[model samples]
Target: MTDQTVPRKPPRRARGEGTVYWDKRLERFVATRIVGYDDRGKEIRKRGSGKSRSAAMEALRLRVRDYERGLAPGADKTTVSDVVKDWILYGQGQVDDNTVKTREFNCAHIDAGIGDVLLRKLTTKHVEKLLRSMVATHSTRTIADVRACLNSAIKRAMARDLVDRNVVELVVTPRGTTGRKSKSLTERQALEVLTLTKAHWMYAYIVVSMLVGIRTEEMRALTWDRVDLDSEPATVAVWRSVRKSGDTKTRKSRRTLAMPDLAVDVLRRRRRDQDADRVKAGADWKDTGLVFTTTLGTALDSANVRRGFRSALGAVPSVNPAEWTPRELRHSFVSLMSAGGAAVEEIAHVVGHSDTSTTERIYRHELRPVIQTGATFMNRFAAVDVVAPDWHMEPLFRLPGEERTAHA
Candidate 1:
């Protein structure tokens, strides 16, 4: 009798473990799994294809894991671009229009670098590579903003479970190209600018900004109601700004500044000029009640202020309009105050900084290199002992324990 050979049966896969089959047409292994039941009680299936059975099974495992974590079908295919665009469209709420535009512009850099990359597959290496590439052309601030944009977008994705973690947060920001440093006008240049821009439409805006150091946004948002020109000391409230919230940038920024003679005079002239503008505009005036406005009484946007500022500065032969911005006027204020021996604390208060450190850090270039307060106070005592070369009179104050004159 011939010995019978028993054929072994293939091992059976556990229920819901999925099945792998070789496709003759595609010459590849494909894996399929029933991820869920549809609304109609039919199996909702997901498929993963690979060149080999193990590869196909591994791919299907990733899909099943993502689905089990509560991610919707097709979540594995979501791209970084999709996540950023979704965040830009829906996550930001009640931000300024300019802020929205700025984020959109910054996100473009990310999109160009790795926007199409799958969100689930994003890694710290990918983000670091993208930022390092930008280091050559973008400023440090710009690079930082781009990283922040990516971080925020990933956070939004994580909140929705589109990403397991934020790869951007793990990547360190690379040092980027140095940008142009802010500069201030010298005393001579400030005088020239003031004299030259006297007849310009932005004269009051220029005067108030340079002399009082109010931010451009605050200057634009100033209104007649906030002006107290009739008080003992003329004052302007720095209580509002052109931001989306219409509030000051910080709690310290909401201060009531005593206007100088120059600012008070300029604002009076501005009010008179605005009345004339309102008369000329007739029915077209929008009555926005903004201290700075166009002929039609509408609020002046940043673009309008920038263009007018450049035009006004163009009249100054010493100033290059293209090289200067309106914000530099505030820098000039800090420079002049520091040069005139004003304390950093005083300058900080005038500029409405949250603290003196902020003023010192940002305006360090404008501050006096040598601390003169102590030296200045000590000089008074030194001068009391040293008689002038041409001295011919008695000392103003009697020295301690000095003998009285016989004539007394």
Candidate 2:
């Protein structure tokens, strides 16, 4: 074969010939040869791709590096574990609590399981096996969750060059069951809850939550400038959501949410209460600018809000319907609004959902029965002659303990 390597005094060498020529460009040993090139119409020579000319010449001299390594010249072999750690650091500091929870679940359950393995050695079999083993203890749906987590984690690993191939591409993940729709209060039940809440210390706070359907975090982070009671339509700008850390989670979540009429009225009363509170804390109260706050004027926590909501809930006999959560009140509000002939799109906009589809998907179960009376009225009307045609007039109808009844 023609020597395509750098030109030198001695050019011809066998495959295993241990000969090296000093590279004039870099003054280092390199396997050199002169070969004719069509591009320049003359003999050309250049150093081969390697760590250095010396290493390239050594590989040619030994003939061991002739075969492709199937890898690039410079690549780090980071373990999956190291890559996962970097991912966690890059993700957590800026995301909301909900996002943090999702990523944490992926890292702990999926990433940790295969993190120590070499990224290049990861294969489709490993992914399938991990999914299968997870299926034994978890339901098919939960196993699919694991699969999604693995796919996400591997995606990050691949972009960072930690893995040669992401095995998630070859595996087919099972579709999983979804989250349930929340339980909502009926119209009468909602009225009773509203009436009972008026007597509580946190009555206004409770009203703001139920009527507005603002998330608990968003409600707690409300501020004075964010509320415009004098505006023609009025509005409550939900610019921030409180976190367990007692801080706003993200800048985007701090949106200006407008208020409905009922919400506006409730907030008006709440502002009056806040004015009185500010007077009492006078010198002691730091002007936190927070619209909803504790007696001391600091921002409120979700636990405290739920604790207050629960106490008021106990007074409402109708709230005894079934198992309930504070978050479900948002569902109750949306359901009440929909049942009142409000369109899904209207509710979607009022609730600050990205779109109608999101509102429909997230709150489908909460939609109250519009035609519930149909079944109840029919059952009542039909009960007297419910069964067979003309059989009501038949003498075959029997009373309790009768021979006919016993035989039937």
Candidate 3:
């Protein structure tokens, strides 16, 4: 009989190539690879199990690839919470306390949604789903902040080879709940607020904010050394803020603004009141040198300011304290300037915006739709009989003889 060639058994896999076999008891395929040696020189193996041999081999290949790419043997087990907590703990360096707090708050939302998801198994779909779930209760800005926090956390993970990619970067942010709109007080309402709160502690804060348009942060950080009430046309330096760097929000924000008579008057009275408070507190006074302070002479925080502001507003029957924030005083300043026919460019400079575009964009609701400067110039050139509004004839600072000089 002609000798039938027997098929030789398939060559055994080389060492470290790994092994795949059907588990007779479990009735499923399993794969294992020698990833490394333990501290005791024992073999350290990584395993993957699946219903099919190909699936098991694929799972094993992924683990091996991660190990070769410098990831730890159990890198696939790292979860979203692990990465986020790590980043929140260590990734924020030299940042403001407020910035760190904001990241922690935003990251908490991420952990609540997908904290248990494995980093290796995370995908764009997972991130998108998490964002979509937030649409009902969170604002678009809040949603965006959450996504940014996750993206940063994932990037940190990738640096450590815990993840291969940042799936959050690939996901598109979805629309979220409508946020509360910012509003400005009308001139009459602003006057009412000022008059009603005159005897209250927030009087000077309200006057300076509404008239000079200094930010709440800047107002909180104002110091005695920066005020120049003794000089002609008194000024206040807006060179610092409560930010960690102690710099103004922008380079343009580091300007010295001439205080209106109203602002100077209120600030003077506030200084006297603070002196009285210092005597009252005696040794308890902290002497922080801030323009606004608590009873103990400590700096005014947002909570303290808000509580006082609301209590002051309670005296004004026409104005609702619940609907307004201290920041609205700055908005009211913009509105009054625009209504008084100040050019957008001039208002931009006073508000420390780099350009008119920013001023117009942020204060669009407060700005007039027309170009008033061109019309005013044309009216003057033609010697038109058209009368201007009372505010148009009045200077913002209302300095002595300014109105007469403007008319002349």
Candidate 4:
């Protein structure tokens, strides 16, 4: 019998070298490269394909370069969804509960749009498109928050060597829908609101907020120990808040504010009301020590305060209850104090701002009119004063020996 020599397929390329072949099934050229080895000594292959051999070779070179740079190991299989999940898992303990919830909400938008894209393949165009989609239906603030979340998530991924770079940072965020500006009630409107809330359960809350300008979180977290009603000047120490950490928004925000007579009276009444509630609740009361509490003495949250505020506004006829918020009470406080001629520095101190710039920026509308009071005061002594009955003025350029005289 004649031994027929069998034709064999070409030997496989060496370890470091790559190979190119025509893919009959896809009718395209395919390139495969051995880029590196894993810790377990398994060969890591980087693969690419294109319609032409040159295109496939170019793609292979790019993939090998990405591997050499440690750009997202196995990125062809790793989607943006995977990277975002990794980031969230690693960051679970870094932020507050509210911030985590906000991040989660933001991530929902990212996942809905481009989460399926490969992490290393993500580009500025993808991020920009996501932001534009958000702008179409969301407010500027909301869109900005989404952008921030994606940026932070991708930044962490890059730090972990899961991505070459954060493409979200390269995208220019589009302008989104403008949100409602903060506003305060007029003097007459404020008085009406105060009068209407007199018999409501949130009377002291509304009164102290309007008078002291404390944040709702500060007010809700206020405790009896922090309030000094027996002192020469009744005061409330804004040392804590209803935040998960129980800390104020900033060091400046943790302050002591002297109570106006209205606030003092309202607080005294609220103290008595709370005592009655405690007696009624008996063992059922939570005893959280919060100044603002429900019938069971549990601390009030933002939703609780918002609902109560809107209910109180129902008593006033001229104001649209839906348009106003609890925060407007603080805005109204700034307005009232400005109208009463309180200096900007004094207002900033009372509201616990670190500096006047914050007060100016946030309460510019509520600030007293900058009507050139300096000009008016200086005009009183000016030689060209329009209101002066006498019109005589003397020139100060007389010679050394010349007698000085007033000129009319």
Candidate 5:
């Protein structure tokens, strides 16, 4: 009893060899393995812990498998929130600032829902639940975007072998709240909207949007240099948008559209009006070169354009300002053109869509399919409502005792 040296608990398992132990303090079983070394030559080990022995063993097995596959041990503890933040930082210069801002918003929403979940443990059920939770509060498009953002983030994590699979892709996004469908004005309504908004400063904006079909972002970012009024057929170069990088939505969106007479006239008048404002503002003018601007001449933001559009809508009695958005003008343009018998291809070309499928999908209600004479053949039968019953039919040939006079 005098020399009882507590047999040093079987010298802790050697490095690189994995081990499992019960942690009294954590009240859990932990599995650990030596992963590698940091750049500073320090040992980088991975730890997996769970309340149950089997759970800890399974986690440890995953850790060892991932390490053998040359994945970073640091990823074992990485959370969805951590991945999202890393992706945001890594993606800064890859996309436009507006896109980055939108991604950040989407990620913030994702974080609020399931950000605390570990990347390794993220599941399809977790993502589906997140989307369903958002259905009541966010638009379907917004929920779709959130899914896209998280999918992209998890994909990046996968590329780094931080996670095994992208659970976001496995889940079908739930149907979200119904959003306002895009609608076009009737021809009479279109004429009224144009006539009513004519006296406002944003009159040209409405006219060009309706007549030329320029996107709101493209119009807001339009510069004097891109507008050509003196050319035999006036045109506006549809090449830019208010995106921080000044890129159009797509390469096909970088197009030159011929202006309608109404568009040309309105644009010319706007040039003169802007010139006058420039003189009035003098040194205070921002000189942003944007086609749309505030009184001080700085570029108009979406809010400014939206407020002006609603104000313009105030002029029409039948239309509610709250019911319409600026983008609807472009929709109205497609509808009006389709109603006027414009070809789908022509409409798509003018709208800067990459293909007719996009134009058709978006404006299906406005488009009429080409049919020749099927209606003519179908219409005659629609009037045969008074067919005589077989019982009421006269005999095809009269018997010998039938009345003689044809007039009778």
Candidate 6:
């Protein structure tokens, strides 16, 4: 009865220096210890809360190690830019410009915003503030992509020993949990943009972009042989892309696409037109056979595409209210395909997407249950609309009626 009156503490066993057990309203087996002792013997206490006595003892041991290493539980410090740069340089040759450009930009944003801060110094409050600041200046997708890059950078940094651990990984991204998709243009808006594009002195490239869903730079590397104009179901062989490097965008970009009749007709006209231009120039047009090219027949510049796109948008009367860039035209094309009830897989393939899920996510608003038709609509009868009937190639510098066809 005398022993029962007292609490059955673990007999105050000393597993290590300054470690003991204390009983309270909770379990009696909790191991409490002074992790940092001083000359007066007053120090920080780490209390373990495990049901198992051995587990409590283990916690006591871990807390001592953590004190020795100068950290409390769950304290970490790593910066967003620090992680991004480590991964970017780590993956020197792995990703292309399209990938690296966004990553670099995101890294720059992080460096500008909070790169100097320690990882442990980053708080949820700091992240929210930085995110709000970026949102104020950039589009939702751009900000989201930047966040993703930072998160991935931290993950890779951890792998490379650049960081003790990734605190960025623990923090939720500003956009991922928000569930927002990039803005897709309406069909009418797209048509208006397309009409403006046709009149803006870049018809050949614009025609290909709308009809075939080829990216702007991919338009630069297209050649005559890769396009099959005579086939019943004509096709565009996307063999490469024009990159910032004066060459194709990616080795994986050389995929074949089943062209719609509209796109096929557009390509045929452009090819015929370009061929005539070459004959007139005699030797100026390089014999590269690029479907869309500069006057010198070299890879087209990205800036030129942007300028032309901007000019086209400015030309439209009704489109004044709708703010969109040239790249939005790509989204417009995808949106139209989705609206047409095309199968998710079909749109994914035609658009050179890796998976159907990507198509569904981007064009999620356009999905319907007519059955996953997969690219079968590409074989549908040609509904090619002629933008210019009886159109012939005009000499670049010659007046309209004075323009003469140069035979190659």
Steric overlap count per candidate: 0, 3, 0, 0, 0, 4
lDDT of each residue in 125-229, candidate 2, tens digit only: 777776766654555656676676667666776565445567777898653344344678888988888887786767777677778888777777778888899
lDDT of 5 by residue, 1-408 (tens): 777777656566566557788999999999887777889999867777898866886887787777876666677789999988988999456466778888899999899999999887898888998999998978898999999989988888888888777888888888888876778888999999988888898899999998999999999989989999999899889898877678898899999988989989988898889889999999998888877788888988888989999998999997999988999899999988888878788899999999999998888876765653576676675544544233353557888989744321
- For model 4, give the 10-residue run with minimal summed lDDT: 383-392
Q: What are the Cα lDDT values of the candidates?
A: 0.89, 0.67, 0.89, 0.85, 0.85, 0.65
Instruction: Provide TM-scores for the models.
Output: 0.81, 0.64, 0.78, 0.79, 0.78, 0.58
lDDT of 1 by residue, 51-92 (tens): 988899899999888877877667799999999999899988
The regions of model 3 sitting more than 4 angstroms off are 1-56, 67-74, 95-99, 373-408
Best by lDDT: 1
Error of 2 at 254 (Å): 7.7
Better of 2 and 4 by TM-score: 4
lDDT of 6 by residue, 33-79 (tens): 76666788887777664667787777667655645656535433345
Residue 113 accuracy (lDDT) in model 2: 71
Query: Pairs clashing in candidate 2?
Result: 237-257, 238-257, 239-254
Residue pairs in steric clash, candidate 4?
none
| Shift of residue 240 alpha carbon in model 2, Å | 3.5
52-171, model 3: which lDDT tens digit per residue? Answer: 978998888888788778786668789999999999999997678989999999999899999999989998888999999999999999999999999999998988888777889888
> Whole-model lDDT, candidate 4?
0.85
* Comparing 3 and 4 on lDDT, the stronger one: 3
Question: Model 3 TM-score?
Answer: 0.78
Candidate 1 deviation (Cα RMSD)? 7.9
- Of 5 and 6, which scores higher on TM-score? 5
